[model samples]
Target: MASGVDLVIFGATGDLSRRKILPSLGALVARERTKLRVIGAGRSHDTTDQFRELVKEASGNPALAATAEWVTLDYADPASFAPINALITGTAVVIFYLATPPETFSPILVAIANSAMVTKGDPSRRVVLEKPLGYDRKSAKELNAQLATAFDESQVYRIDHYLAKDTVQNVLAFRFSNSLFEPVWNRNLVETIQITVAEEEGIRQRAGYYDQTGAVRDIFQNHVLQLLALVTMEPPTTFDPDYVRRAKRAALRAMSPLDVTSAVRGQYEGYLDEPGVSLESRRETYAAARVSIENWRWDGVPIFVRTGKALRRRATEVVIKLRDAPLDR
Candidate 1:
């Protein structure tokens, strides 16, 4: 929200950057009329001018491109971060957004901590990490420890972009604000809740990342779970982000562990032949599971969640089926 904010996006040329980050930043600049310095950081050897062209093309906003610059960054090399540090002024708010894979997070954070950009206890300096945070519970803990070394919990943000979607945010408003729905949102009136996130496109350029991270890790862990939490969470006392997050966490804690035996996993036909996919890979492109929250409000209600790639249609929806009214006597 500040005037002189420096936004350094790692993996600037990656799919996520091209598809989401750059475009969103461009729109933000256009909408807020804020003075933002965009630094596109990647391992690519592209010059500043070349990177600006890429930003212009991806964001479709020349004004965003005009404020953009590029810096070569190597997660393993501390010296690579020097260029990034030099670009930052003493008083500017610095935001480091990691758009790279989870494995690279540790080294990148260490490199950032060693640089002059991050001043300890400075809230103005922040880091944003995109999920899936890690492969599993143990790895996630390790990642948290790594993050702790570089930033305070307050300064570190683990983001699931799905939560930023208007429809998804509206779920909270629809449940809490609508008297018609809020009264009947519990298990007594709601029979079941089904969340489905389907994608029509196959793993096009992300075969390498997709194969390593299947449907469960890629979608179910972050996006699907966040949706489930939003739907099942109790109304927070306040609209503050921390309170909302606590409500979501409470809902997640009440949910039963997924029953592995009842889970379904499958791969799309011809998936094995996709580039970077192993011939014998057992990675699933589709996954579905039955979830239950053992809480007063949601008890006896079944929550079904599923996500997939190369599906019949591309849709993300939450359907709540209510109990039928008694027949007329």
Candidate 2:
């Protein structure tokens, strides 16, 4: 509707955009923090009118539905990226939200770079990406390179929504704010640290996708590892971005690959017996492993992480099993 304030979505009609993104953006608009002009780009066959209606239904939020714009795009098509660039010509801010999958990331970046719509050296032009950053370290680096070719690392905001949660922030408060934790957190005072995330659910519908990427790539690589990093990272002299990231990367690097014997990777059978999936594929439905950080601070501490689909209840928690005090008192 307006010239300048645009919050564009690369995949507007998808599950991520409709279910979470639109509602969150609507909340921002409701609070009057942003004057939003949502531009939805995807390769849908439907017209703008049909797409808008779809968004209205998908969003289910009355506030966001009132302010929605739909534009069709194909990342595979070279012509699609220019118009988006033209829309960003004025002083309007641009926020590219990539709701697409990990595989589509490279081509999308290439298109954005080749397109006429992208603006370099603009602070307001930000791109938000969700994790699992990559299937592994190599893929993550590859992804970083592709984007770095066109945009600076500072321009990329790698969003881990878990960091936004109150529980996660509380970990920092418990560790740094209290004398109890910061002092006795070393190997001398502490024993093994077990961080477990176990689910009882089976792969009811996501069998196809889940089969391809098991617990390691899906959960441990991002959420569990990130949580462990936050919990175990040394207190920074000053809490700055560079220092915090450095600490995390160091913790991650310190962790070695898990031994399959100590780790349990299980998959529930009879899923394909219900409907779509075939019998031959043996993708894991459940996995649990103990990750040890080989450092002076946490030399023998073991961090256990477990996750699965179609469980009885859905729970995500980190338990710090501290070592017991001596029986002298």
Candidate 3:
């Protein structure tokens, strides 16, 4: 709450809005509610007052609820952008959020960029893109180029919510802060690395998106890859954000051109029966791969990455299997 700003969420009526994003914001600005002007915009017909009430119920706290104000937006109407446009003018830091589907992303950004009264170079404006930015590698690049037209590199924040978990944070603290791990962190002592992210629930309400994305795009593209980078990345020169990101990028880059010989893709039983799924669906609900890093420190060792929905156990962690000690029997 250091500065007063507009906090706009585009998909305000979506399930993510009620379940996590809105409530997290409430918790964030509970002490300094006045610093943040929470604005929720969506296609629904709810007024600012009615949407305010929805925020209250979803937030489960009166103070958090009072922070949110809503604006009705229709994708087809030019006039619907008026309220948000008015709010974005002369902004300090407009933390614009696109909490909607990937398909709506490009159009919304275009609308925002086109409708804003101020210049696109406004230093205060930033857009936070949710996970699964595109369907695949090609589309991802196009989406990146499109987003760049509106916001500079520094002004864009692509979020991987799993990175915010306490368990994940703890790993960084242990790895960097402790000097002992580096001595035995490479292929010399580590036989193989295993990273797993599992889910117990099936494709409940997200079949339309899930059937298209499956575990590969839904999990591996962002979550699993990020986890792999974090666990195996070379130690940075320093723990600063840029340096840390560099190490992670290098780690991921080393594993390029994934070998399909060690990869597996599977569809969970009864996935076709899920609502919005096709009977002839060839998509995979489960994906596992053996990632081989072609670097000096990890040349021979393989990192096994796996993620799936409707799994028996739900867990997420990085496991470094060490080489057994040689002994005279």
Please identify model 2 stretches exceeding 4 Å from their true place. Answer: 1-4, 57-63, 86-91, 198-209, 269-278, 325-329
lDDT of 2 by residue, 200-318 (tens): 65555555445667777767677778788988888876778788889888988888778888898776656556445667766666778887888878887777778776566777787
Q: lDDT of model 2 at residue 111?
A: 84
Instruction: Return the top candidate by lDDT.
Output: 1
Q: On residues 241-266, what C-alpha lDDT tens digit does candidate 3 reach at each position?
A: 89989999999899867788889999
Runs with alpha carbons beyond 4 Å of true place in candidate 1: 1-3
Tens digit of per-residue lDDT, candidate 1, span 168-226? 98998899999999999999999899999999999988876788999999999899999
Q: After superposition, how far is residue 195 of candidate 2 from its true place, in Å?
A: 1.9
- Models 1 onward score TM values of 0.95, 0.87, 0.90
Q: Which stretches of candidate 3 lie above 4 Å from their native place?
A: 1-3, 31-34, 87-92
Q: Which of the two candidates, 2 or 3, achieves a greater lDDT against the reference?
A: 3
Top candidate by TM-score = 1
2 or 3, greater by TM-score: 3
Poorest 10 consecutive residues by lDDT, candidate 1: 83-92
| Lowest lDDT block of 10, candidate 2 | 201-210
